[model samples]
Target: MAFACQRDSYAREFSTVVASCSPAEVKTDVNGKKGILKGFHVVLKDTLLFPEGGGQPDDRGFLNDIPVLQVTRQGPDAVHFVQMPLNLDSEVHVTLDWGRRFDHMQQHSGQHLITAIADLMFGFKTTSWELGRQRSTIELDTPEVIPEQVEAIEQTVNEKIRQHIPVIVRVVSVDDPEVEKVRSRGLPDDHAGPVRIIDIEGIDANMCCGTHVSNLSHLQVIKILGTEKGKKNKTNLLFLAGNRVLKYVERSYTVEKALTSLLKNGPDEHVEAVEKMQKSVKLLQKTNLNLLRDLAVLTAQNFKSRADRGPLFSLHRKDGDNEFMNIVTSEIGTEETLIFLTVGDEKTSGLFLLAGPSELVEKLGPRVAELLEGKGAGKRGRFQGKANRMSRRPEVEVLLREALAGWQPTEE
Candidate 1:
C-alpha cells in the first residue's frame, strides 16, 4: 500500500512499502545540538514524512514503532533515516511526530500570511524564509521595516488567523489560468506538471510545497519579535507562532525574575540600578589604581645601595604588574643604574624588567630572561616581559646582580 501523503498532508498515519532499504551511515551534528551521529537510509514508495524542504525541517516519526530519525528528499524519492534498517519490500506503518509536525505547520503557515501582508501593504516582497528550532524569519526585499509597519503586520495577520479561515490547498496543471490569479513570484525553473497553491481565505494564495494545518486558526497567534538588517538591502523579520511564542514568553519572564532578585530592584528600576552600580565600580577602580601607583614609587625609593655592584637596583614584591614596574623604574633617578624588578605571588608566574646603560642593558637583558627560563627583547635601555617561573624570582635578581658586578660600561 503506497499512500501519497503529500496529496493529503493532514493524514498522520499511513501505510507504505519499503521500496528499498540500504544500510547507509549519515554523519550529522544535528545543528550543533550534538556531535556527529550515525543512522541508516531507507527509501519508501510513498511516505507521510515530509522530507525536509521549503525552509521546513524533516519530519520525525516512527516506521513500525522504530524511531525514524529524519526524512529527506532526493529527486523523486522520500528517504527516511533511522538507527536500524528496515527489511526491503516490507509493508511498514508510518506515523508522523504529531507535535513537531504541528509546530512546523503553524510557523510555516504564519510565514505565508506575514509575507503576503508585507508584499501587499508595503510592496516589500519576501525573498526567503527560515523555520528555525526556536523562531522563524522572513527576509524582505526592503532594507528596513519601520516600527509602525511591523505593528500593522502583526495586527493584520492575527486578525486573519482569528477569523478561523479555512486553509485551501489545491493542485493545478502547470498551465492553469488560476496560477496567474495566485500571488506567486513564479514557479521554480525545474517545476513540472502540477502546481500546488495554498489559499488563505481572502488574504493570500501563494505557491508552497510545505505541509500546513487545515485552517489558519491552528496558528493560534503570531508574534513578531523584531527586525534585523540582512544581506545588502534586505531585512529579516523574526517571529514566533503558537507554542514557540509561549516558550519565548516563559523564558523571558524567568530571566526578568532573576534580574529583579539579583539587583534588589523592581522590573521598572533594573536599568537604573545596573547603571548606578557600574558607575560606582568604575570610580573604585580609578581610586585603587592611584593608591597602588604611590605605593610602588615609595617601595622603590626605600631600597638600599649595593657595594661594588655598579649601581645595581632590584625590587621584588607581591601583586605587581607592568604599570607598577614602570612606576618604580621612573622613581629611581638617573645614574647608569642597572634596575631589575620581579613581582609575583605564591601560586602564579610573574614579570621581570631589566634597565641600565645601553651597552649593559643590551648584553644582560636577554641573559636575565634566559636565566629565568623565559623570553624577552630590548636593545637601547630597557627590556621587559613576563616570566613563567615565579620561584625563579630570586634567581633573576642574583643573575643580574652578579652579571653587573663584573661589568664595565663603555664611554657615552
Candidate 2:
C-alpha cells in the first residue's frame, strides 16, 4: 500500500496511530563531529513523512510536537527516529515540514522533466540523478553534453513547465501489464505492495518511489548550470530548479556587490582589475627579495667590522628568508666566530642557523633547537632548521656564550 505521503504530496498533517516504538541508537555528524545519538524508532500505522530512499533524503517533521531526526524505510514500514517514544496504538498528530518537502518536490520533479526531454530530444538516457542541498545533477549515458544540447533541453523543460502539464500518480499491481510500459530499474529486494508510476501527461511515465510535484507548473523554472565529466564515459549535468535558482541568484548578486565596493570597479571590470593587482603584487615581491639579499651582505660586513666582538655573534631579521641567512653566513666566514643567524619575528616563530667549528656546531645545534622548541640537523659545521620560539633567542645566546667561554680555536 502507498503511504499517505505518497498518496497526497500536498498534505502537511495526518493523524495516525503508533504501531510500535523501540529504543534505538543512531550515528550522526554535527558540524563535522561524529557522535552516537540516542533516540526511539517509532512506526505509525500510516504516516505523511517520506522515508529516505530513491535518492531523495528523508523528510523531517514532528510526531506530536517531538522533532523527528530521521526517517528510514524498513521493508514496507516507515521508521521515524525521535528523542521520545510514544505508546503503542496511541493516536499521534504528524506534521510535515512543508518548506522542505516542497523544495524537494520541485527538484525531483525537475529532474524527471529534464530526463524525459533529454532522452526524447537528444537520445541521452539518464543513468542516475542526485537532488542536492543547493543543486541537482543527472548523469547522462553519453560521454559529453554540448552547450547547444543543454540549452535545448533546458528550454524544452521550461516550456513544458509553463504549459502546466499534469503530473499524475498511478498505483498498479506488481504483475500488471501496465508496469511493462513504464521505465523502471526493477523493484527493490524488499519492496512490497503495488508499484507507483509517475506519469507526465503524454511526455513520459517513470516508476519512482520519491515524492514529486502534482503539476509541472509547480517546478516554476529549471536552469542548467553546466556539465562535468563523469566516470565510465558519462556526463553529469548540474541544474537548479524553482526557489533554488532564485536563492543562487541572490547570493551571487550579493557577492558581486561586495566585490564592487572593495575593488572600486563594476562587476564587468572586476576580473581585469584583479589581474592588474596580481601583476603589481608579483613585481613588488621580486623587488623586496632583491633588497633583502643586499641587506644580508651589508649585515655580514657590519658584523665582520666589530673588532672587540666575542667568539659568539647573533643577529635577527624579521624580513629575512633562508636565502638571506645563508648569504650572511657565506660572507661572514664561520671559521673564527660561531655565527648564529635567525630570520623572522623575535616574539614568535622563525628559522635559525648555527654555523662554526664542526664539533661545536654538532653538539650545540641540538641544544639551541631544543631551547627554541624546534628540530634541526647539521653536518660540515652548519646546522639549520625552523624554530617556534624566536623570543628565546637571548637564552640560546647565553648557552652559546658559556660553551664558547671555555673553548679555544684549534690550530688547523
Q: Which of the numbered candidates is closest to the native, going by highest lDDT?
A: 2
Give the CA lDDT, 0 to 100, for residue 174 in model 2.
Answer: 95
Global lDDT scores for all candidate models = 0.83, 0.93
Residue by residue across 70-133, what tens digits does model 2's lDDT show? 9999999999999998999999999999999999999998998999999999999998999898
List runs of model 2 lying over 4 Å from the truth: 308-412
Lowest lDDT block of 10, candidate 1: 301-310
lDDT of 1 by residue, 261-372 (tens): 9998899998999999999999998888898898987876675343454487777777777898888887774356788887786335778888778777878788788767
TM-score attained by model 1:
0.76
In candidate 1, stretches whose alpha carbon ends up further than 4 angstroms from where it belongs are 1-5, 8-10, 23-27, 30-38, 185-193, 291-412
Superposed by TM-score, candidate 1 places the C-alpha of residue 350 at a distance from the truth, in angstroms, of 9.8
